[model samples]
Target: MTSLFRPDVEALAGYTPGEQPQESGWVKLNTNENPYPPSPQVVAAIKQALEGRLNVYPDPLGRKFCQAAADVYGVDPDWILPANGSDENLTILVRAFADKNDLIAYPYPSYVLYETLAEIQGTRRARLQLNGDWSWDLQRNRPLIEQAKLLFLPNPNSPSGNSWSLDCIQKLVPPNGVLVHDEAYGDFAANPHRMELLRSEVGSQVVVTKTLSKSYSLAGLRFGFCIAQPDMIRGMRKVKDSYNCDMIALAAAEAALLDQDWMLANRNKILNTRAQLASELSESGFDVVPSDANFVWATHPVLKHQTIYEELKARKVLIRFMQFPGGIEPCDRYPDGKLDGLRITVGTDEEIQSLLKTLRVVIEDSPST
Candidate 1:
């Protein structure tokens, strides 16, 4: 049979999102979604939006959402570009900046979507491996920086939940390439690398993305935005869909951004729970990576990650077990290129307690080393 898809798309493996099971009574902690519900303002705004605007097309530029983001982030509205989600923003970025056969670079074991996006665009990819401690090494990745036209960096990077310093990231900005700081998990971190500072210094060369999904408890709403120079924002807007974010999402995102206090309160609660969970897991012979995200990346001493994941699932508790080769290697663990680990999302107090109890039982039943 003749294939209609592009050759690159035909050959490329697609991104696998975290599983969303339909069954009730399962302690779902695989995806790093916030356990809390959206802010009251968000709910109200969404309800208000739906009351009369179902028939009208959404504001194509998402001005209200952009202004809300600007007010919160201390940037101008012209610097913001709202999208259906950060994923769509990333796609627009790839399409706007790099062409087929152009070079695109990202740290290995970071967001898998970056690589997948580059593949779909038929762009050359430079997958730079992190050091033994899962830290970026600009000196080692000098060649990749030199060759690439765009770089995607995730702060408090996924799977490992470890972050790189702003100084380190500044050192890695390619001279002739755009640097995209994917700060989806920035709100949970102690010291988020300030995009405003980077933008002031480097102008359009630096682009930072933020998603309402993780922080604002609006994953289902699917809204995200990017901050960059006006020129960059203008270029990306041209590539984006005419109605990227629908009316409900725009209203919800604006309300969520306005209710920053609610988001911060939930963030503090999650951070506290994260600390307790990490401590408990470590005491139970699991090497839990220090996290700045809403999830913990951990590995057990005596069991393969797959075993632990399956065992937990069998008990009606779900967590992520990923085995992307060269994806994550914390503290020289998995030195033999075995990047297998479990990413457990932080849930509510009762939910987390339930997860801990199940985890203890699973660990106790495993065979001794």
Candidate 2:
């Protein structure tokens, strides 16, 4: 039989999400999900939406949710386009801007999904490699930056959870391309929103995508949105699904954004736990990076990163062990090659304590480590 799929599609490796065990009793932390429950209002709104709402198609534009998000994020309703999730936003961006011949560039080792999404579009992809300290060589990458049609940056990058400065971010703006700030973990940072840049003259080239999964405790509810200039939003809007978000999700997302206090309280708790977790990991001979996100990236000085992840998993604890396909260029900070880390999500105090206990035992048992 003749193959119908494109050659690239046949060769492409789809993105692999973190392990989602079917059973319970697992200290699941591989995915960075909010351990706390969403705002009480979210539940009430969802219940209300369930009443006689399923029969009809949702608002094609998701107007109500857009207005609510606008109010919360202090942006105009037209400047935001709500989506099923941030992943959907990324897909739409690729579709809207790049094609098989065009180039899509992004900082490597930040979000692997960027690579997968670009590949799915059958577009040319460029990896702007990060240095050992998670910093970029702007001069070296300037040609790609200018040539790319889209550049995706996960602020407070994943697997590292380190944030670059505003000046550094500004330097990344392309003269002819769009810069996307994937602020998935922005809620846990001291300075999350970049409203000023979005409102500035250069705002025309910047797009910011956010999600409810991490901070709003709505990972189960697929809801996210992107903020950009009204013109850019309008352009991307045409690329998105007519009714990208369902009624239930719109209700939940609106309620979640409106209840800012609830989100803030949960964020504070996670930040605190993150601090403690990083300290403990450091004490255990791990090289912990100072993080602004809800998770810590720590490489062990003695034990192998994979060994730690496997041992912890055997004991029913889950944490992320990630290595970039192309190893990062070694710098003074990272002298030893093949640097990888355990990306542990900051869960509840009890859950984290249990993970630590098991991890300590695993380390002690591994004399070879």
Candidate 3:
């Protein structure tokens, strides 16, 4: 009659992801998912793979898929490590390097998954707060970096979708730490990717992780990967499961990567709609942070963030909300604390339009909000 979980697992509340409603009539714009179907070629490839085999195990090294990814990113096939998703890769990395009492650092109001993984790994999680403009504070973070063994940063950070410049990131390389850059939304950012940073001699500590989920619209298939020094890649390989990504997922990801035209076209569409959504929301009395990803972060200055979140949910238009203590207050309130607000993903033009229409109706109906 004893409990069967670790003390940390028992003590902590689990991470809450964006709302994914199964019921009909809800417009889900919470998870920053791409608003288009994957490439026609991807669909065809999955069908073809399914026709051939169901009985064999997948490639443990995931070489063919890795080669395709390397071809796209200009990295060596040996440096590429594919996983079920970036989430799985993150878990493996944490397990490989982090242990109880070991330290990991990240910019707060960033990816929640890092904190979740740290808790699960029984490692110490150091949360660095962002600056007023929603950028990293390198000077303040220098001490934390010097003390930590592993560091994770989401470029064009999640929920709050802004990024740091190459110069800014270069200055942040902790002398003895493995800096893992989660580039989940790098495809949509206005800046060049941190991949260039990885190529430099100064990039010994940096590793970049990407996903087919966002730009390629392959979230359902769960294909993602990391590019690191061969040693780091090998270390993660040592701890990973035998068959991490299935044959069908690998085939679909390969096809998706090859269909660059389709990918680029949809990215452009989402970018256009994202700009329009920010502008429209701003004009309607909402203060929106400029975003480089496929989502917009906004808050009504006069309206409580939670109230807005609940209101949107009641209307069946799902969006993400952050619930930090003191709730988006000045820095002194929570130095290592994450700030919270609403994260609304950019959908197709018609889908975004529907959301806009609902917002107008809700605001007009509830004058007090």
Candidate 4:
């Protein structure tokens, strides 16, 4: 029997999320989840929402959370559009701008979801390959950018943890495209907010999407939002579901934004642990990327990353082992056909110590010389 689904949908290998192990005692660091719990305020707010409303429909606009985000980010409530997750914002961006076969470009080896989203929409993708240092080759990719209708770039990119400079970001904005700045790890970076770009004359063409999953310690809640000019926000609002974010999520988001101190406390702890993790990897004969996010991207000098990952997992430690098989544009510094590395999430101090201890064992015990 013939399938009713679209051909691309039928053929697509949907995005594979980070592994979630159900068993206990595993130091789960594959996913970039905040090590600390959310604020007491967030807990209290959820409890209140549970006692108040579960039957009625949630606010389609999520105005309360919008207003809180606006206050925190110095943007107007109308300029913010809340969603179930920042991933939804990406879907909406593709739906709003790109048509089937329309050009959607993004930095290669960044977030693979952008490609998955484009595939779902049957849009063309021009991978803006990073020079081996993880910097954009604006001159080389200019033509691709010129043709792109939507561009999704993750700041402090996943699996790399390298943040592109603001000047670089400005230069990569497609002249006739909507640049979706996917800042999922922005809260952990030194320079997080890019809202000033929205105030500039060229603001209309830029859309910044954020997720509470990382910094706000709300990964389980599935809440996030996008920031753009009011007009652009209105257009996106029309494209989104009537109530994409539920009542509990809205309550949590609002509370999380208002409790900045708690988030900062966690952010600081993660940053400290991240530094220690990177240094430990470096001292253990691994080349570590200078990370601006809550994780570190590194490669072992002697052992294959896959081997290291497997050994670590065997000892009840889980981390992401990633590979870009092909379709990634290479650079002179790394004139390779493919790239692979490890992305280890920043966990608690004890977790880091366990990771380092186990990593040492993996390295010392390796049969490879």
Q: What is the TM-score of each predicted model, taking all chains together?
A: 0.96, 0.97, 0.94, 0.96
Per-residue accuracy of model 3 over 1-369 as CA lDDT, tens digit each:
776999879877865655677677878898888989999999899899989868988777878898998898887898899999989988888998888877888877677788888988888878876775676667787888877778887888877788788887776666777788889999999884756888876576888889999999988889899998788888889999989989999999999998999999999999999999999999988878889899988877566667666777898888777765533325543343445678899999988898889888777766453
Give the lowest summed-lDDT range of ten residues in model 3. Answer: 326-335
In the range 1-369, model 1's lDDT, one tens digit per residue, is 888999998897665656888768889998899999989999899889989668889999999888988898888899999998899999999999999867999988777889889999999998888875777777789988988899998998987898888778886777888999999999999998875545656656899999999989988888889999898899999999899889998999999999989999999999999999999889888988899999999987668778878999999999988877655435557646667789999999888899999888888787653
Off by over 4 Å in 3: 14-18, 326-338, 367-369
Each candidate structure's count of clashing pairs:
0, 0, 0, 0
**How high is the lDDT of residue 36 in model 4?**
88
Model 2 residue runs over 4 Å out of place are: 14-17, 367-369
Clashing pairs in 4: none
List model 2 lDDT by residue over 1-369, tens digit each: 777988878788654656989899999898999999999999999999988559899998989999998898788899889999998999999999997888899897778889888888889999998888888899889999888888998998988899988778888888888999989999988887589778766789999999999999999998889999899999998898898899999989999999999999999999999988989988888888899898999887667789888989988999998886677768764665455778999999999999889998998887554
The candidate that wins on TM-score is: 2
Of the candidates shown, which would achieve the greatest lDDT relative to the real structure? 2
Error of 1 at 224 (Å): 0.5
lDDT of 1 at 175: 83
Per residue, candidate 4 scores C-alpha lDDT tens digits across 1-369 of 899999999998755656887778899889898878999999999999999869999999999999999999998999999998888888999999999768999887788888988988998887888777787778899999888889888997887898987777777778898888889999899987588767766688999999999999888899889999999999998899998999999998999999999999999999999999999888887889899999998976457888888999999999999888753455543456468889999999999999998988888878663
